[model samples]
Target: MARMRIQDIAAEAAVSPSTVSKFINGHYDAMSASTRSRIAEIIERTGYRPSSVARNLRLDRSRMIGVILADIRNPYSSAMLGELADRSAAAGYTLTCAISGNNPSKEAEAVMRLAEAGADGLIVNTCGGNDELLADTCDRAPVVLLDRDVPGASIDLVTSDNGCLVAALLQEVMRDGVDACWLLDEHNDASSVRRERTATFERGLRSACARGGCIALARNACAAAAQLTKMSCSSGGSPIGLIAINGLVFERLVEALAVAGIDVPGAARIATIDEYPWNRVLFGGVTTAAQDIAGLAAAALELLIERIERGRGPCGSRRRIEIPGNIIARRSTRTDSGPTTTTPQPLRAHR
Candidate 1:
């Protein structure tokens, strides 16, 4: 609803334009007491307010936070959104959320637009581009990096513990007697999360005797997988197991395996980096390092709000927080037996 205006109040009160302006602008010293009282009564009855005056009165407050998600298609992103919404509402702030479709340029546009529209703070799933713009924007308002991060940018970050998680998962696969393992990572520059995952996997490998073979799923995941296997067998080689980088990659691996008539954990054992709600029901279940979506979401919201409300100064120096997740062992990574009864628990891979 439109707010009451000073003109509406003056017309109703039958007063000169200057008289009302003086009264509204708090210049009542020259006005008679009766006239001042009349204007006040009219304003009270009509609920009149000057938009510009009101805006100037509370220039420090907007009560709105903006969110720039890298990709809404991610199930983790969806879960984080719901959690962020709940926390924002509880903290008396509304949210303006936008998706970047994992495009850096679109991410920059969304961030700039939201800030221009007066968002008090921002939570960004950065597409790993526009570092300069992101840093500059952070100077205006608190920018919390969610899930993914930008290189050489000092900003508050909340992400899963991909390092420890990956290392542990790889150790477990080794103990399971898998001769060779290949990690199917979608090549991209927009995701630091993927980079971290890949680095941890490489460190764990340490130039093992057995390596992996598979390449180019851009044209078609299934076709690419078919070609990868055909080439491997032709060259007298095969991957004993495969580790999918994330859910999308995992889905592609599943599709490829199905099309090539390769039984998971049989023809080729399988494990993935992300665990979804549907993981348990798929392919006799899948082994995955589960991300703590709720924990990450809550941490991101809390950290950004703290910086916004508590003041962004020396104490608010950019902080990076990593929350660990469970390594859920499902049948997809089994080496000997078939799929068994599934339970939600963290696998004992540390020992």
Candidate 2:
């Protein structure tokens, strides 16, 4: 069968191709209800699918954006990407995703590929080491950094407030009067988010020490687990609390703790930065700083559109949007309260 075209649909409906084009583009302000109904019926009967490529070319724009993520394996990054796609589609734009796998060379290559493919804009969750390449890319297209920031890059950014999130989590741990606190990270120099998280953890620890609480930092999950085991064995059983920087760090910590036969709220307490469905099911529940996924998506899209419409030139001023996350209280950190079950909630997405 021959592929249907806009002219074919217009001819069958007895309307001009321009009218059909306007209807397809959703410009129905001055269109009559009868005409609109006729076009809709004709389109359904003919099973016509509009050519996005042709329409985009006619507009002299690609109407497509690229989203470069540091690691698609991370639950937080995955959730944010899903929200961005939904919100971008609602705004009549399409999204293409690229994963850098936390490598600087891979990240630079992804940026170049997306630009070569004629993407109108880019939203990136940076891998923390692509400063020069990212700066150059911003000169070629509108780029919005998300979740992580690249230093010396003069692009708009959307991320959660790191300082506030850590402070809130620390407040809960200190209030419970845990014996010792530990901060766990997979590697020290992975991404900007992890760096900021580590800095905040140190500041929180200083504050906790001022209040007379013991605190320490672990280079890797294995080291953290070793320390937990040593403390548990030496003290003949004392309560130790740990704050895992992110989901990956949390997983390693859980595995190590399980291997050592550590009990939650009995031998140790756990808190993490981001929470997903599995976290809730694992130890009954875990406390976390849930990132504002929808807010970040909305901010990223608005920034990208603003830059694209502003035309070719340096941004008038650097814009940084910090979306505040919420602290989810659960059974992992609860001492006197025993294990309690809470209904599993679906993650929120951008509209």
Candidate 3:
């Protein structure tokens, strides 16, 4: 038996091949509901799969967008990607994703591959040290930075206000009467967001210490949790509080704390900058600053569409949009006055 083509479906539906193609590509404007239904039914009956290569050649567009993430294992990154995909689909575009695994070289290679694949635009949660390659790509195509920044690349960016997030988390720790505080550092190059968060954390710590407190830094989440455990075990006195910079760091902290058999809020306190569904259920909810994933997705998509429409290279006129994150007060690192119980809810509800 021979395979059916789009022309067969178009003929059955009594529509032009271009009209059927436009409908298949999700361009519903100017298409009547009846026409859409007829075309959809015919295509389904015919088992027609539009050839993406032919469609691209006909329309001069791949009708696809690319998204790159530093690590897809992180729940936050995955959530953002999901939201971005939905928004892009609604806008008549498909999304292709690549995971860099936090490696700069891999990130660069992924960017080049996506560009070569004829992605109309790119949304990147960049790995550090790919700024030059990113700049070169932006020079050729529309690029939007998501969740992280690339220095010296003048492109539209959508990210949470990490500075305010860390500052607010530290404020809660101070209010809880934590005598000493520690930061779990995940070492990456000084991206704009990371630099801002570090500076804000230091400033907040300085202000808190003037009122009588101390802050320390750990190499990473595992080390920070370990040090906190050792300090709490050896001293047998006041409790110490620790702050994880992101959801990935928080997971490592939980693993380290569980290995050491440390009871959160009893032996020590814990807080972090981001929260997902598991955080609410696993540890009686962790106090965290939550980013607006939906808003971030909308903003990124808007910028990308604008850039594509303008056909402009990455330049000084592009805006850096920093969306504010909200503080979720949970039991893990909160003071005695903090909420005693928090019901586990879908993270999507918070958005």
Candidate 4:
């Protein structure tokens, strides 16, 4: 029982060693269909597994991609990670994942550890506070940011278009007798996607001759709940719209509304960004803006692979990709008008 190398596999397929190596590494541009099939058949029949370590040593690439998520408990994070894993494997790469739990210190540690481990590149859903470390790491490896973007980091970013979707949702809510809207967010940090959505909501309210404000649910859900209650009461019985920044905040707002005996579409209307399974079942199907999880994963992978295959470009010319999300109008924000659902659209990448 001896090990088979690339030369043996190439000999059986009647191809050169470089061709077999290219096949293993997924470089099929110059390869023909019949040649690919013959090589694949031989490799499958011989059970020839390529040695990743040896290949990496020769190629100077680990074939390992590092992924950092702020929190995996959130449905969007889990879904996006699953998509990334599947796509990475098909592209002949493995993924090493880390959860920062939204702690800056933990996130910094993960970034350094991954870089030291010789990861070919990194796809980070940053929690902020690591701009300096992230920027410095760019000199060592290619980095593609996911979800939240970090300022001053010159890294390629792939994120959902928050402002446009929020404006569309606000327009729908205003038609449902919602004179005042409240933006509920768990954090006010730069890492939070709430920043863009909150700004868009405010502008939408002002344009429509409506009023609204932001409530910081930062580390104190109870205080936020009380503030919401007070705001609702002082509105003089006018219907108020409540917009949760993400799924985590949406869950808390739902619980708080139930405890306060407030009814959806009756006492106050409620909706949120980031669609989840629970959202479709709660409160007669909650209204939501669903980000294209698949698109985000694919775009991020494309950017990382490009940088890995090619060399780094000018930092000032870094790419920033924004994928549009769909708005699902359900009963939560329902009025006399019928429910509607918007179709998901293609993405736009900017530099």
Instruction: Give the 10-residue window scoring lowest on summed lDDT in candidate 2.
Output: 342-351
C-alpha TM-scores of all predictions: 0.76, 0.79, 0.76, 0.86
How should the candidates be ordered by lDDT, best one leading? 4, 2, 3, 1
- Listing every candidate in turn, what is its Cα RMSD in Å to the true structure after a full C-alpha superposition? 8.0, 5.3, 6.1, 3.7
TM-score of 2: 0.79
- The residue pairs in collision within model 1 are none
What tens-digit string does per-residue lDDT give for candidate 1 at 1-351?
Answer: 666676766777788877898897799888889889889998887777666535534657687899989878767778789989998999878988999987878988999999998888899988876788988999888899997876677788898877777776676555455656666767564378877777777766765554553333433766857754763464344336677777777777777776777766665667777667678887778877888888988899899889887876662377888877877776767646654433223323321
- Supply the TM-score for candidate 1: 0.76
lDDT of 2: 0.77
Per-residue CA lDDT of candidate 3, range 224-265, in tens? Answer: 656666766653466677777777767777877876778887
The TM-score of candidate 4 is 0.86
* Superior by TM-score: candidate 2 or candidate 4: 4
Model 4, backbone clash pairs (residues 3+ apart or across chains), number: 0
| lDDT for each candidate structure | 0.74, 0.77, 0.76, 0.84
Q: Which residue runs of candidate 4 sit more than 4 Å off their true CA positions?
A: 6-47, 218-224, 343-351
Best by TM-score: 4
The residue ranges of model 1 lying beyond 4 angstroms of the native Cα positions read 1-59, 213-219, 227-239, 335-351
Worst 10-residue stretch by lDDT in candidate 3? 342-351
lDDT-wise, the better of 1 and 2 is 2
Error of 2 at 16 (Å): 8.9
